[model samples]
Target: MGFDSFAMVDWSSGNDTGPRPRKDAIWACVVRQGKADEGPTYFRNRELAEQWLLDLITTEIEAERRLCLGFDFPFGYPKGFARALTGSDDPLGLWEWFEHRIEDSPKANNRFDLAGEINCRFGGKGPFWFNGLKRKINGLPKTKADYHSPFPERRSVELAPEAKGSFSCWQMGGAGAVGGQMMTGLPVLTRLRRTFAGKVAVWPFEVLDTPVAFVEIWPSLTLGAAPEGRIKDAWQVEQVALSLAGMPIQDLARHLNVSAAEEGWILGVSQRKPNIAPPPLRNDCFALPAGVNWTPVDEALGLLRERLTVVTAAESLPVMQVSGRILADDVFAKRSNPPQPNTAVDGYGFAGAAPEGAQVMPLCDGRAAAGIPFDGVVPGGHALRVLTGAALPAGVDTVILEEDVTVQDNHIAFHGPLKQGANTRRAGEDVAEGDLVLTAGRRLTPADLALLSATGVADVPVRKTLRVAVLSTGDELIEPGGTANPGQIYDANRPMLIALMDRMGFQPVDLGRVPDDRETLRDRLNSAAKQADVIVTSGGASAGDEDHVSALLREAGAMQEWRIALKPGRPLALGMWEGVPVFGLPGNPVAAMVCTLIFARPALGLMAGEGWQEPQGFDLPAAFEKRKKPGRREYLRARVRNGRAEVFASEGSGRISGLSWAEGLVEIEDGARHIKPGDLVRFIPYSSFGL
Candidate 1:
């Protein structure tokens, strides 16, 4: 069945441009069943427009009519962008990702900075370009001439013959840069998806099994010339909405059935073949291959690295403010370190290459101190009094330390046979001008800041801090300090995971806890997608009846159950929640902590632009012995004392005390063997995992 109502929104990403109806502002129109077309409504900002739309949707829902909503901006970027930006090829995931990163208000927004940030992820070249900001944005170029897109310039839908004149979503400004409209518009869509939840479906991506469907539209496709008195944006939206609403049910259904899941398809662009149903949406990038059961730890790690890419964008910050940030592009010295030749110490400066015996030279008229140059050059046989960090005067190639020379009257006496340029700092001695000071993907430290500052780099381009949301699920869980009823236990995983993320330098967003209800978990996850780059949940990861997290993900067609060949933490669920990556760990505290450290740590690091982090381990003599089984790797909570590794007394997954007791973990490889007291074992300290 087709929609009974149609709404078209001509969106804008700009500020509240004032009360008068004008161009470059939001214009929306709706045509409802059994009613004349309503509203070519004008809104100054997205907030008002969104509220009005929401109210309209509520009214339509009450009337038991389905709505087809359309927005002007592209719903997705060109193919491959979603995969590159969010580790998934699903455009809706990109929508959720943008929902979290883009900050929009009436008067101001961070679209330019956000666009540049995305460009920075592509090494600061660009798939996005053209800055409209008064000041410079780090990776975003000011003109199309400087752009070098790593992905295609346009989506396939935009290239369709009927859509020939449509603007590329990559162009950010200077005439028809729909990219700004998209950056601001997608978040609203994401919010609408959340607000509507189960009742709404995004066309071309999900099957239209809901009461409402949202699709991308180009008003120009159906609108001819506007009436002379009407604002073009308003006229077009009204006309388009009415046209779509008036179409035959069969024709509308055909339009709705066409698919382009990765790069969203625009309605009315191409004709669909009769009786051929559109293919189902492509499998999410996180979905595992069929028939794969238990995966090895190494294979899991490899899969994570292969599938995940940086989700956070980059921003330009002052060098002093960039410490602990990952560098987005290779930084070059603006000018050389020691910029020009200068004195290394308070001394008498003169030309070198004099006689090998003791010599006396007449002094120049003035002294050269730091930031103050001597007025005149030093003559061949003359010296000038110079202080430390003073630029060398012309005709002077060396300096004799004040303590090494005897100054009397207008002359200084010192021994010759001195090396040329001795006691004089050379230009570019530390870092030459235009030399690469820091490479891309490097995490800046305080020392790195000093080096950058010394090399005349005032600003640094760095990846934005990755924000990870921690969630815990289980009906039996309660917050700490809460009075627990029968069967309920305190939730330990949320705090532990949040702390772990913080310790690893990611911004952790506490999503608190949700009980074992699928709907509640779904709502929480939808909300999390708007606030975090990744989600780490400690429970409901298995396929058990109460495992709502994994079950909900599977229902959404994005879940992969990886029964890893490891003790304590075997059921690891990897999935996507509204496009945001979700890592599902075991319910037991010990197993949850182990899976997170062994898997999520390195994966999150890569997504944060820090690249993969392999925990360093050292072989140590075993202080405890046990028989090991083949086909499964194992990690035991252990502490080193007197050069030997000692494991916890119990290897139980429920022992939360062991996490606190151990200083490190002793790893056992997948093989059957008897580990004697003197056997060598690989010990990885907690510090190595950034504890």
Candidate 2:
């Protein structure tokens, strides 16, 4: 169903929390009872305002009416802010970063102090000015003259191409300055994401079509053009709501298609055109902070290898038992494969090089069976019968095959002369003494064991197996094979990752599901860390995550790294928890699988002491066509049909079956996104990855 009700939150600028009603706390306007011309109901504080909003949403749901929620603050800053603070370009990256940095409650918060600290990180005393406190806050400017900002005064969204006259987010406690509101506003967004995760669709970040969708809006855009005599705030809300209600569905769709991932879009910015589909991401927005560069697939693979320290601890195992395990040390041949020269083929062994053509040699008295070599030295001009693996007797330097000579009356006749080394296997022919055989960090295969056995290496050293713990977080998830309620799905990521790790030879410890509760998830993850060398979690890793596993990692002083330039798995989170490395994958089943294989798999290998082993991919022709943007790398789930790469029909990452349907992934390079039929793309087989 389309949106049936509209709501807006006019956030307050007050910094104090008191039991008494706040004069400028938070005000909410809702189009209740399907009446778009209705005025707003004032809320005195954030606590009451949010509760009332939730109640309105619940009421709408009961009546089976979809709702559209709008808030006045910017959803995010311009691009570089995310890269500087969180090493990622995802807008939610900023949200989670802010979540950890800000401390807030219903009564009072450190919004001004937090702004000052943020300004310092970007170059102190200027980016954030306007200290709204009774006393001076260190580093925060008391007057406009003291402002010294390291960055530009306004963001890209506040300048040309977007909306003009939008104030800087760095302004705190000043007229028209949204800095304080944003500091508090983001936390509210996070809480809402957590509270109404499954039901609410956050536009531009998540695809719309859920029961309710929330977008960032500017009241000034509409209120500035309000009719005369409608200058009141409540009256403005009523008129804006009525104007929005009059818009056709198709018109809203055009506005929904906006180019504002980091900085959100205005709700009614496309009424005239009403079908303003977003253009391809322009190049100007790609400019990120210095030292923060896009990581290509090969470079990412190299980085992973650089981080994986070769396993130092080694254990000795019998050469036969070491198969399927990685070597921890280099192995040398104890002795050559052949201690003495032997015949490489069934032939006659002569004592010395034969004369030029038609030489006659007396046949040996005893044939040289493989195990029973002739004991007596051959007489001059004589030959001995030899087999493929039979040892050559003393003074035997060449072999004449039976097919090349005729034996009659205990003598052999030859038409052609024999060379000294013809048909003769020299000593150490396969391997020389003390030669390097198998190197450390090489996984033991059947062939490796055979080589070790042939060289007489009795034992080999290998590293211990790495322990990996897995968990899936979300309230809308249930264990696979269990009955699911409406809007619930099975926990595919946990099991999928567990299997992926197993294929790579790591010991996967299943820690199971964690509900959308912060404390419970933290406890469970901490416990998993103790039992595992590496921990993996799927879901609750996104910026919009209600139970934000990424935020918890930040809270625990974890060193989280992410914002990789990869498609389908951009939301991946990597960090260390309680000394154990953790990989937090996106909740989408396909994204979880892709991130695990492309990113987590290598990191896990490093923790296990395995040096870089990149999954092999080969170039193949594309059977379908696709157009993608530049900068980010893309991997399309594809299968080989008619010897050509065919991607899955649907591009949605949530489709788990696509992973199963795919035989491999077709990798498009960082900048090359356009694909035509017969175009060569890198295809990485699932088998090559041991999947």
Candidate 3:
């Protein structure tokens, strides 16, 4: 059961210590519902402490709040001790026995005397030991040297690895001893349980359905060192109470499911390391400042660019398989293209300056061809037969194209104006070794692969493909392939979003359609968060009765709705669900597609490690005239015709056919404008957005 508040008490078994707030005195802290943390109130005696606790419980119960009250002492004895002392195995029976025999007051208490009486009943040697009094009792010893245990030294919970530093509950009257405190504290708890009969229940021993549930706590289990100038006991109870109150309801419920009824368990005993899911990278990256409303188009875009970051991890893949993947690291050329100088064309090689006019030279002994270099060098004023792609041999400075020369008797003749070093390729001319070829965040293309392959790059480091889950929410919606009733329409958003994501090289997880029920939408979102890097839901995004998508995000404290100043689309919901970013779009098909293209597309590209993608636009003559408002920017579904841009016949956002009829969008800036034919306007094609 979840608790509305928490109260932790550090118990003391000593006499009336004066009111200076010293150590070893009772300190109780209460963290009330929706209120600031209450003080670690000091109590000099058990009577005063019990009265203060009962008053707090009364206040909480009157307010209708459930309280998880914890006390720093053992609530139950070791397994067999309770059965032997009470005849039954119930631990509360032992509480009753202690309640009837124990005597207490402000001046002193009978904790040590009771321990001696219990020891005398069990053969007079003992499970309980130690005495801080000047005179020793008959059965209780003053030290461990004379003590003998009839029961186990520790409970099962004390042996757990997380509870390693806890002391044995049998050690009474010494430093770190809990036996004295347990003997004194359990009786007061029994009275509280009896006085408030049905209102209070002990955890792990009874169902925690009452308004107040009592549990055992060991402050040392979670406490660090106390701060300077603060009393250690006060610090411990305050910090422990705050920690318990801050835990998630679900996590706090897990701590109450232990099975140590006969030998009570300490809260948070075996749960030092919880099994909750790890949050995603930069989980709060999409958070917006509170009170932000009516954001402009430019401001919204800027916020998206500033807040989003790459969420995908990188890995190395073969160059051939890296196409369409974003580069995670910059790539350098391992070897230069045209690694060594070679002939650019099939020609004759020579070693001489270009002749002023027609000139002829004797042929050399060897000929140069592709992949077959000439073994012999040509003499001055001599030429050798060479082919395309042949490396330059010694004494070769120029090549004469075979088509431009005449070959007679193995001698080539070429005309003047044939510049020196003409037609000969230079080493590292295309790319130099160790040159920065491709930068990180670039989407690898087929042409880029060719460049990398030529530069000796066999493997490329690229980011893993981002998975985007697409969902459509509305009770009035059904899948397109299924038959639709009169009140239901075929779901169009999911298929459109999936196709858009696939075209952008993202893996689209089809989450199908969800109804308007909040719980059903919540379940779908949770399932989507596990498998997708991002989620896109196209309906229930606004602040309407059926808008469960936005409502659920708000419930998680992660929703941000932006009333953007843009036509065709306005309300855009941005939030995180279980660490995965979610984009909530309008239910109308036209607005959904428009918002996805304008906002979600660039944001998703940034998250996919592709950096930010801005759609390219061109200015063209307007083919129609219209007057636009000044407060919001407008995008009209348009197609370019004969050097002019013509928008769709109607401007209504619900006209789904207009989206299919247009090839692009004509953007009008956020200002009043009287547009007419021949006026130039910016036009962005669907291809520019990778449609």
Candidate 4:
């Protein structure tokens, strides 16, 4: 018989409000291997919940596996919340509180008036010595009655301090601290844990103190696209339950229907010359396909840490550091903007000295600003008038302000002597002969272009724009430009998906809509792969008959991974067609966009030389109520206000309006079936994904 390694309990606090039970209060226990048909059970009280949890452990789990029972509540509470509420600096205030409240008698050494005394007393060594009797009682349950000790047991109920030993009380803060305020799920979980020891193990989310582990799953079918019995898919709950039963990694991957190597093949065709005879089919056109693994989103990304490289080399690009993105490379300056020395202000440039009290006459050398400059310099006490940013003439050393010099004759006299090199602009100060402005791999901006133009540069060396091909699938879909027939829907995916590619720095080639035709798909894919670096087609990536994109992928090229175990975009396909990466996205607009943000975006980042391109997630309070199915993760459309996040009420993957109303997305993984309002949930802004 196998050890009953899985323990489950439906947990919840009786005082829960805010329109939903706490997520930690409900538990789904797996007694043995194989998928559990039932979902999580709800509990109204801790006593009833703990009673049922203990029974499950005793009956279903074998003695050896009994210790692996996982409660759906928090095991270790945070130490901070108690300090914040009780105004006690000591870390053990809550723990001491437990000791005082649960003790056999209220007068049992009323030193600190600890809270969980009855709970911590069991952790002590000796039988909470009744009078002078010396006995041992370590494993007794918190609810156990008076000691069962035999010989010479006294009637006095006072607990000896020595019996307590070094058992220093500590507060179980964490989520329980939040629960302390609302008395939601934390206390119920605590009561359950204290009721049973050594029969359960609590595993928590990476940073959470609660024992619930969030698992995200992907699938091959949409929520309601296909009938119930027809859906063939695996969920995250199945993985977690099976893995906890001690399934090996390789076996688990295989059980999840993932392949470790490439076992298929693909072909490509070259362009033909016009008026030339058709060439015979060649053997070189066919080759063995590349092997790619279909894995969970987390697992798939975890493997690329050591195997990926970023490319950023291009020709004729300007100096990338100073100019930002290089508009063009190896390009030369057209001509100097200011062909001569230029003045920086409106003043007079004169040579030599002026006569005493000799009023200088104002003579126009010329009007010079940025584009125009004075041709000749002032010679022999002659003055050349200059303006701000105007080129100063040759041989003029001093410039006097027009207001300071009183003009009476053909010459000008300064009320005060002019300072040399004052207010004069020099030629070549902005740029000298042949200078590097921008370099390759630099993204060009308006400011960069201005600097280059100022330096006498034009027509820069920019890398040829990366050509990207975008296409949409699904027989039920109709082009937005055309009239919609009965039972057909207009296509918002093409435009929305194309806009995503555009913002990501791609020159998009809209391939229009592709019906569920294999031959047409094969031809279009072959052509697009040759012309574009990436081919993005939304819809029809599933295994259904109407979902023909995967089949067309095999006909056009080799596919690496198909159907990642993720929600929203589970039926995603990653393949190489004619040397270009082709992404077969889910047909639903939301799924297509999400898949692009998650899988396609990262893959594009890899192609475009970015080290990483993942969205930044922040933990915020939930503003609205939301419920989720266990075992599958979801990106709930949500809006954040005043540091709190509230998911949209109509957060269905097929709903487009929800996406529009959401300011960001809340990512809820497995183990978290429902999020209560005000709970801190992780969210990513729409702008972060370049939306």
Task: Per model, state how many residue pairs clash.
Answer: 1, 3, 0, 64
Q: Which stretches of candidate 1 lie over 4 Å from their true place?
A: 1-293, 353-357, 559-561, 621-623, 639-646, 673-679
TM-score of each: 0.56, 0.57, 0.60, 0.45
Candidate lDDT (C-alpha), each: 0.83, 0.73, 0.84, 0.51
| Model 2: per-residue Cα lDDT over 1-691, one tens digit each | 2578877777765644355533354656676433542466666566676678778778877788888887777777755677777888788768877877777766677888877777678666667788988887777887678677765666555665336667777778867668888877777677767787788877768877787877777766534333233334454455445435434344456567766666555554442335477655647433444445555556555544543344335799898787767788889999897867888889788866776888877787887767888887877677888888888888687888879888889888987765678988888988988999988778788999889998889988888787789999999998779999999998878878888888888888999898889889978987887787778898877556584787776443233344567778866666545545568888888888888888877677666666665789888889999998887888889999888899999988777789989999998878857789998988999987766
Runs in model 2 with CA error above 4 Å? 1-312
* Tens digits of lDDT, candidate 1, 1-691: 6778888899988889799989878998887752336468899988898898889878888888898888888888898999998899989999999899999888989999999988998989899988998899999999877569999999988887678889999888877879999988898888988998998888789988888888888876644445446787887776567556545455466567677879888887774456677545666322333433356788777667765679889899998789778988899999898899999999888887666899899987888999998887677878888899999999888888888899889888977778888888889999999999999888788899899999989989999999999999988999999999999999999889999998888899999998888888888988888899998998888768998877765543333545677876867887666556789888888988999889998999899998898999999999998998676789999999999999999998888999999998999997887899999999999988888
Error of 4 at 163 (Å): 76
- Looking at model 2, the pairs that clash are 17-107, 126-148, 194-546
| Model 3 per-residue lDDT tens digits across residues 290-349 | 432356788778767765679899999999899999999999999998888888998888
In model 4, which regions exceed 4 Å deviation?
Answer: 1-341, 349-372, 379-383, 396-434, 481-488, 502-505, 515-520, 543-546, 551-567, 598-649, 662-691
Span of ten consecutive residues with least summed lDDT in model 1: 284-293
The stretch of ten residues in a row with the least summed lDDT in candidate 2 is 222-231
Question: What value does the lDDT take at residue 157 in candidate 1?
Answer: 85
- For residue 135, give model 1's deviation from the true position in Å: 58
Provide the lDDT at 166 for model 1.
91
RMSD of each: 21.3, 21.2, 16.5, 25.1
True-structure Cα RMSD, model 4: 25.1
By TM-score, the best candidate is 3
